[model samples]
Target chain A: MNKSIFYHAGCTVCVSAEHDIVKLVGSENVTIINIGEQKSKISEAENSGVVSVPALVRPNGNVLHINFGAAISDLK
Target chain B: MNKSIFYHAGCTVCVSAEHDIVKLVGSENVTIINIGEQKSKISEAENSGVVSVPALVRPNGNVLHINFGAAISDLK
Candidate 1:
């Protein structure tokens, strides 16, 4: 499963979601990308329709906004 | 040393600074506060004259903005 979490440094929600995601999926299976560190990925995140940080890109190419209930639920 | 790092999730700079801080002071010595998770701390962070995320509050009650070169230098 190709799972990547695109996040920034100072987003509290993102950190929470990251903890949950890492717990559920195991840290080894996940790729945590700091958007600021990877400047090139900003456009890629934008292309995926992510206007905010803490977006999770699933294997199916669907992006989940971590703040949304649906996204958090989906993680479970 | 009572060192606390006030940070939010999704901030790339904070993550980098956090790594540096943990390396310098050891993770056990520093407290990483996700300002989003700890809502009450937001006001405290603001009260410390921090207008942005990733501010570090030292034991002396002085707050350091992580984006500033001086802050990073001080960490070293």
Candidate 2:
């Protein structure tokens, strides 16, 4: 699955949600990118229709925006 | 000493720098505030002349802005 998680550095919600994402998807299966540290990723995230941090991109290329609870359930 | 560490949540540099700050200040002596999560702290940090994240406010009311290396050296 080409799964990626886009997050910003100083977002508390992102930090907290990431723990659960890693647990649910396993660390190796997900590509976690911090947009704050890597500005290039911002374009990629924007292209995927993600305007905010803590977004998840599914293997099917669908962008899940901020609903970490729903994203986790969808991933499961 | 009224020591506080002002940081933004999604800052990778802040994340790395905080580890060093915590080690130097011993967690108990420092108040680590995430400005992104707590907007009120922004004004407090600004009052101390802190314009960016990863700033260290010394007990003397001096703000060390973004100079984590210098801050650590001064703390030690």
Candidate 3:
């Protein structure tokens, strides 16, 4: 199975979003690229059209920007 | 005056912390090493004893972990 790419920046919101995405799609089904930890992934993330952290890139290369406000609210 | 090194990971909290620090200490008084933008700085950050992002390294080599909660709240 093709794994989706999850662009993370190691921020609170991104970490929370990761948990939600991983829960939505099994951990094994996604590959996390922490741009904050690995700068090399910044370009890759940009190439994938990620303008911000907590973004999801589907197998087919579709990028979805996660909403930090929504994610934070869900944490409560 | 020696410049303080600010270790950043390009995360929301770190970004906000940077602003506060820069405001507290003039930008010229600090040097920001964006670990998220430069992978090479990871080791440098670790050597400075930065356990997390938004850390400040004094000229004397002391590390201070900025409180993310405080930084975030201050953003409001």
Candidate 4:
């Protein structure tokens, strides 16, 4: 699947999270779009309908918002 | 305005971005929806049409997608 990940220091975890997925999809398969410190990304994010930072996207335009907490993963 | 943030390890940076906004809005004002490892969240994100993790959502149902790199911010 065509993929893209976004990350930044404002949210370091977001950066890391994006990295993990990027790794899973692999550099060749993923279209990495790093926002870094771009405020425009904020607007882009909004225009794209992203509620938060560090978003995982498929070319099909499907998206899932992620929140990492022990509640779900801790069980594992 | 009412606000929400969704994040996870699959995209940790998304998590952090959510946190920062959460802080800005304050716990009392925000409705924290922690997806953790619950697969349902993934579906929720899709149902919501997030198109990415760490989505910043307004009560109005508006969303923003974040990607970090600096191409946009670096200019600033």
Candidate 2 residue-wise lDDT at B21: 48
Q: Per-residue alpha-carbon lDDT of model 2 for A1-76, expressed as tens digits? A: 5455545444666776565445434687678887766767677777776655666566555544442222222221
- RMSD to the native, candidate 2? 15.0
What tens-digit string does per-residue lDDT give for candidate 4 at B1-53? 54444333334565655555444345665555544445556566556656545
* Candidate 2 residue-wise lDDT, B1-76, digit = tens: 5455545444666776566446434687678887766766667767776666666666655544432222222221
Which candidate ranks first by TM-score, i.e. highest? 3
| Candidate scoring better on lDDT of 2 and 3 | 3
Q: Please, what is the whole-model Cα lDDT of each candidate in the order they appear?
A: 0.54, 0.56, 0.66, 0.46
TM-score for every candidate vs. truth?
0.40, 0.41, 0.44, 0.39
Clashing pairs in 2: A9-B9, A9-B10, A9-B11, A10-B9, A10-B10, A10-B11, A11-B10
Q: What is the TM-score of candidate 3?
A: 0.44
Ranking by TM-score: 3, 2, 1, 4
Task: Write one digit per residue (lDDT tens) for candidate 3, span A30-58.
Answer: 89987776877677778777776677777
User: Which residue ranges in model 4 land beyond 4 Å of their true spot?
Assistant: A7-10, A68-76, B1-76
Write down the C-alpha DockQ for each prediction: 0.02, 0.02, 0.02, 0.03
Candidate 4: tens digits of C-alpha lDDT, residues A33-64: 54545555555555555555455544545343
Per-residue error at B64 for model 1, in Å?
30
lDDT of 3 at B61: 67
List fnat, each candidate: 0.00, 0.00, 0.00, 0.00
Residue runs of model 2 more than 4 Å from their true location after superposition = A67-76, B1-76
In candidate 1, what are the lDDT values of residues A1-76, reduced to their tens digit? 6555545444555666566545434587568876655666677667766666566565555554444222222221
